[model samples]
Target chain A: GESVGLHLPTLSVQEGDNSIINCAYSNSASDYFIWYKQESGKGPQFIIDIRSNMDKRQGQRVTVLLNKTVKHLSLQIAATQPGDSAVYFCAENTGSWGKLQFGAGTQVVVTP
Target chain B: EPEVTQTPSHQVTQMGQEVILRCVPISNHLYFYWYRQILGQKVEFLVSFYNNEISEKSEIFDDQFSVERPDGSNFTLKIRSTKLEDSAMYFCASTRTGVNYGYTFGSGTRLTVV
Candidate 1:
């Protein structure tokens, strides 16, 4: 699970289109970044991850991008589907053992 | 593909009663953690357990809250006296390694105070 804010930013995309979610991390020393997708009442499901040493990593149809200078991260989903709707969060591991700081999540909606 | 397991998917208790939330992390994992999410708020870290002791905890994990590894396979979070505000979804997570690797989170136990 990840920390959330008072409100979650929502993104709505067409079924066949692509969806891009963004997050700005606070710690400069964070070395590992993970993205999680959470459905309504369940726990977060790991989507993809990228380490500080790499700028980009790709999975089945998802890609993660990291910008060290700006401490920004983004998750890109290609050909979105109905099941793609969920809250997406970006978490950073501070290189301090196992503590993770999570960003406010983005609620994504996919429409057919 | 091992997963974390939590007991009592939903719990309802009196405001002043003591409630214990249980979790069974992946058998081979070395690190365990507890997290909670209020109705409309973000997920928050509560505590992290390792080697039969607490490794880290947040401010929210105050005097009334405690965690234990009473058995080899069970980890529990105990609230000495519950409050209405304590109603939330508590999640348990674990990782095989310390970091760099990802974690597996339990489905969660929804606690409700009556």
Candidate 2:
């Protein structure tokens, strides 16, 4: 079956440095993608999103880059902070009803 | 900011017992959804509800699972008979109709079947 997947399971980064998380999705028909942050024991919080028509989108301190040609998605966090330490998931919206298919997730750790 | 609310942060039930997970989506939101994540697994979509009916459902949402919007505010998911594999964290989410919007998710309900 087609699915979404992460390139890395964990990422360790120094505080104040930029962090990049990568994801790969198998379905080319997927039109919308979202990046979510989940703290321990909490639901996923929306960070940013991009449509297939656009290649990149930016938020407060985050940026989402979509590469449809390669079926790749990446989330870049600038000046990573301790609060940024969490499991980040990349999800693709599928079907007319817009049900999201989520990747396994990449755990980001920010160290001082 | 408005938020989605879920009840009973954690629940423990014996196999074969029924369980109902409750949620209250943002008041003005038009679409509601249910998703679940097992330990060490990805979040999986179970069902999406809109216009007081199910707009889409995954294969995981079998006959044993049901969803209801009993009133204007509360949406619920019921499992007729749970199995050990049913243990997971259930999250409720809501979103307004749009292609550019993101869904707001509740904290979640952790169900443990023994």
Top of the candidates by TM-score: 2
For candidate 2, what is the TM-score? 0.96
Question: Chain A only: TM-score of every candidate?
Answer: 0.93, 0.92
lDDT of 1 by residue, B9-81 (tens): 9999999999999999999888989989887676778888888888988889999999998888999999999
lDDT of 2 by residue, B21-75 (tens): 9999999888999999988789999999999999999999999999999999999
Docking class of 1: medium
Q: Tell how far residue B23 is off in model 1, in angstroms.
A: 0.4
The TM-score that candidate 1 achieves is: 0.95
Against the native complex, each candidate's DockQ, computed on alpha carbons, is: 0.58, 0.56
Among all windows of 10 consecutive residues in model 2 chain A, the one with the lowest summed lDDT is A1-10
CA lDDT of each prediction against the hidden true structure: 0.90, 0.92
Model 2: CA > 4 A from native: A1-8
